[model samples]
Target: MKQHPLLLLVTLTCIPAWSLQADAVNGGIALIPLPDSSIAPEVWYHGQRVLVTGHDGHWQAAVGIPLSQSAGDDYLNITGSSNKIPFTISHRDYPEQHIFLNNTHQVNPSPDELSRIHGELKQELDDFAVFDGTVDPHALNLTKLPVKSNQVLSAFGLKRFFNGEPRAPHSGLDLKAAEGEPVTAPASGRVLMTRQLFFNGNTIMLDEGQGLISMYCHLSQISVHEGQLIQAGDLLGYVGHTGRATGPHLHWSVSLNGVRVDPRLLLTPALNASLLPH
Candidate 1:
C-alpha cells in the first residue's frame, strides 16, 4: 500500500518511487501529469480546486479521489484549457468494520441533535473548501506524523456497522492514544475551526492552503483557538474520547481539495509503508 512518489514530498520521506506505480485507485490519490507551464495551471474537479504543482520536468495535480469515486474514466479541468486531463481510476474494495457502542444516543441522535449535526457538517465542509490561493503551494509541506506511536494505522475507510446499523465509512486514520496525550500539528497552517462537533467532539481543523486541510478530532482538550497560526509539531489538543468514539484516540483526517483520501499517502516513506492501505 505504498504510494507513488511525490515530486516535492517523496525525497523527504525515503519511499521507493516505483512501489506506487499507479496511484489512481479508489480512496487514493491520482497524480495526474500536467503540461509544462511557467506558472502551475489551476486545476479543478467537480467544482473543487485542485493542488497543481511542479513534478519532475513538468507540472501535475495531486487529486484526492473521493471514496465514492467510481472505477472508471475521470478527468481534471485545467482552467481555460480546452483539453481535459483524462485519468482512469481503478476500483478498490475496502473491508468492513463493526463496532458496538454502548451510547445509544451516539448510534442514533435525536431530532434536535440531527439539526445541529447538519450545521456542523456544513461548517466543516465550508472550512475544507477554502483554497487559500494566497499561500505558496510548495511551502505547504505535509511530511510529519501528528502522533508518535509504534503502532501503524490499521483502521481507515472502514465501512462500520455501528450498533447493528450502517454508518458512513470511517473517513480518517485513528491513532491509539491515552487520555491527556499531546496532539500536534502535522504542517504549518491557520486553524480554521476549534469547536465541539457532534460526532467529532472537541475538534481542530487546520487549513494548509491549496485546499489541503487537516482535522484532529475526539480530543479531551483543545489547546489552539480559531484563526491561530501553528507550525509543525505545535500542540493543538490532547487525546480523548470526546465525541462518538469508543476510547481515547486521535482521529486524524487529511482532506485534499475537500475530499478525504488515505492519510498515509502523505506520510514519510518509512511511516507510510508501516501503515496498511485502507
Candidate 2:
C-alpha cells in the first residue's frame, strides 16, 4: 500500500519521536535529542553550529548529514557539556545518470569561465553559511512546494556525468516548468542573496534561520531582493532555463548547517498533490 505524503509540522511543546519522522541516511536530516535543559541547547558539528529547536527542556539538534558522509556512528558537541551525544546513520545508494550536451562549454568551461566560477563558488559558500540564530527555527514552515508543476526533472544525490565526464552529484531537485511559470517560496525566510552567475544564472538564496536555508536556481526572473522578508506561497520568480540547462526547469536546493540535503525529505505534499516521482 502506498502512503500519502503528509506534512508533520512539529511544535516546540511536543516533540515527535525522532526516528520515525525522517531518514538518517546521508544527505538527510537527523533530529537527535539533547540533554534536558531549561532552554535550547547549542549543538555544534564540524565547527558549524547546528540548528537546535524545541522548548520546555526537550531540545533536539537538526543535524544535516553530508552526502559524502559515511554510514557510521557520529557525535555532536553540546556547549557546557563534557559528554558528546551520539547518533548513527545507515547507507543508501543513489543511481547514476549520464547527460549528453551538444555544447562542450556547458560540460567543460574555458579558463576565464573557470575563474568566474571559482569566485561564484566562494560567494555561494558564504551564502549557504548564513545562519541567523535569532529567528526560531520552528517558526520556519518549509513544507510547501516551490513549484506547482508535478514534472520533476531530477532527484537529489544522483551521480551525474555530463558529456561523458563525471561532475558533482545532483545536489538539488529539478522541476520541469514552462518558461514563465511562477515560482513560490515554500517557507517564511529572509532572502540572503540574489545574483546572476555562470552556472545557476538568476539565483535566490533564502535563510530560514538557525542554519537552515534554501536556494532557487536557473530562474528567468528574480522578484525578491537581498534581505527581503518573504512569506510562504509568495512569488519568488519565474522559471526558465537561464543557466546551463537543457530546457526550462527550476533547481531547488535545501541546506542545513551549510550542507545540502534532499529537498523532498523536507517537503510535504498537499491533498492529492503527488510527491516527487520515484
Candidate 3:
C-alpha cells in the first residue's frame, strides 16, 4: 500500500499522544535519573522513610506504598526540591463479600454500644499517630512470620465496600486462627497502646523504634501495656474475634512511621529478626 503524505503527517502527530498514554498504564516504577549529589538524601511516603539506593549513576528507592492509598494515578513529591514524578496504579477489584460480618454471637453489642466502641478505637489510633522526626530508613527492625499458619481470610490493601457503599481500604492482613491462639510480636518494640475498641476489640499497638509500629487487633486478651518494652516472640495477646467480625481471627498490621505498609515486606524467608527503625 502506498503511504499518502497526509497520513504520514497525522501519524507523526499521534506518536507523542500514544507515548503519554503508555506511561499512564505503566505505573510509577522508574529510576530517578538525577545525580545522587543533586537529590536530597531522603524521601518519605505517608511519613515512613523510603530506602533509596544509588547505583550506576541512577537513584532508586524501595518505597513502601500504603495499602490505603487509592487506586489510579499517584505522585511522589520530592521534598526540598521541585521534583514530582507521576505514578499510576492499576485498579484492583476485591470481592465485596470478604469484609461483611454475620451476626451470631449473643455478646454482640447493639448499635449504640458499637458507636461507643468506635469512639474508643479512635482514641487508640490518635495515640499511634506520632510519626514526626528524621529517620534512618534502615534502622527499622523487621522479622519473619511469627506463626507458621499462612491461611489468610483477608489481605492488606483491599478496597472495601460495605453494604454497597465504598469504605476505607482494609489496613491489615487478617489471619483466621482458633479462638485463644497465641499472638506473638513480629519484632522487638515498645508497647505504645493497648485497649478495647469498638471495631478492633482488644487491640495492641507496638512501636518498633523511631516511628515504625505494628498493630494487632481483635484479640481475646491483651498481655502488654503502654510504655512496656517487648521483645520478639513476646505474647501481645490471644487471637480471637473481639471486635467486629464474622469469625475469630487476627488482624496483623504494620505502620511505618505512620503509613501502613505491607506486613510481608517486614518478613524474611527464615523468619529471623532484622531491620532497626532509623
Candidate 4:
C-alpha cells in the first residue's frame, strides 16, 4: 500500500515510546525522535527539509534554531504525521558589538551600489535554499574545524553597530587568521554555490547534504569552483580582509534547513572548551 507522506509521518511520530530530545534555545539544534528505524521519514519545519539521522533503533531529525527566531512556542511538521511536534524556543541575550568601518560605503552604499547589493542578496538567498539529498547523509560532522584557529574574534548572534548606526547582527563566527592562510572544508560535501559579494568578498558555499550547508567568506583567494566535490580538509580558499572586513580573517557560517545558527555550536567539545576563557 502506498501511504500518504503525512499519514506515514503521523504513524511514526505517534510512537509514544520515544520522545523528542533537543535543546530549545536560540542557535540550538533540535533532535526530533522518530518511531521507526526502518523507514526514513521526511521532516519539515517552515517549509524546509530537516536533517535526519538514526541511532539505537530510532531516528531523529536535527533542526537548527536560528538566532533570529522569536522566543516561545514553535512546531515542526512531519510530512506523514497527523500532528505537529511541539517545541519551545527560549530567549538568549547576546552581547552587543560596535565596529567602525573605514569604508563608509559598506555601511551605507550609494544608489548604484545599493542596486548591486540587492542583486547579491537575492543570489545568496537562492544559494541557501538548495537542499541536496543525494550526498551521503552520514558525511556531515559539523564539529570539524575549517581552519586551524582557536582565536575567535567575533562570536555569533552579536548585535552590531556600524559607525554609530545599528546594523544587522553578526551571523557567523570570525576567526583571527592572517591573509593568505588556507581555509579548508570542515566536512565532506559538494560545492553548491560560490559568489563574490559586495560584503562577503570571495565566498564558497558547501552543501553537506540533507539541508546542512556551510559557508566560507572574505577570502583572499578561492580554490574550489561551484559543483566541485570536496572532502574534509580540502582547500576551498585563503583568508583575507576582503569585502567589508576590518582585517584579514575568515568568516564561517552554518545553516540547517535554511536557518542560520551559531558556528560554535558545530565545534567539538574539546575545541570549544579550549577556546573559552580560563
Best by lDDT: 2
* lDDT (tens digit, per residue) of candidate 4 on 43-82: 8888898887665547777788877888999888887788
Query: Candidate 2 overall Cα lDDT vs. reference?
Result: 0.81
Backbone clash tally (model 4): 9
Task: Encode model 3's per-residue lDDT on 1-278: one tens digit a residue.
Answer: 99987775454333211110111111122223333543335555445454444444445444444444456765555567677656655544444433444543324567887688667757756655655333323223344454446667776666776545566677777776788888988777778788877677788887765456678988988887898978778888888887676678888886643556556555553432222211
What TM-score would candidate 4 get against the native?
0.88
Clash count for each candidate, listed in order shown: 0, 0, 11, 9
TM-score of 3: 0.64
Taking every candidate in turn, the Cα RMSD to the unseen true structure, in Å, is: 6.3, 6.9, 14.5, 5.4
Residue 231 error for model 1, in Å? 0.9
- lDDT of all predictions: 0.80, 0.81, 0.58, 0.80
Which digits, one per residue and each the tens of the lDDT, describe model 2 over residues 259-278?
A: 99887766543411466474
Tens digit per residue, CA lDDT, model 1, 1-278: 77655643544323223222228887788888888765668999888999766545567788888888889998999988999889999988888988899989889999999999999999888988889877644323345567776354446678889988999998988986789999988778889889998899999988887888889999999999999988888999898989898888889888888898877777656656665332
Question: Would you list the clashing residue pairs of candidate 2?
Answer: none
Q: After superposition, how far is residue 216 of candidate 4 from its true place, in Å?
A: 0.5
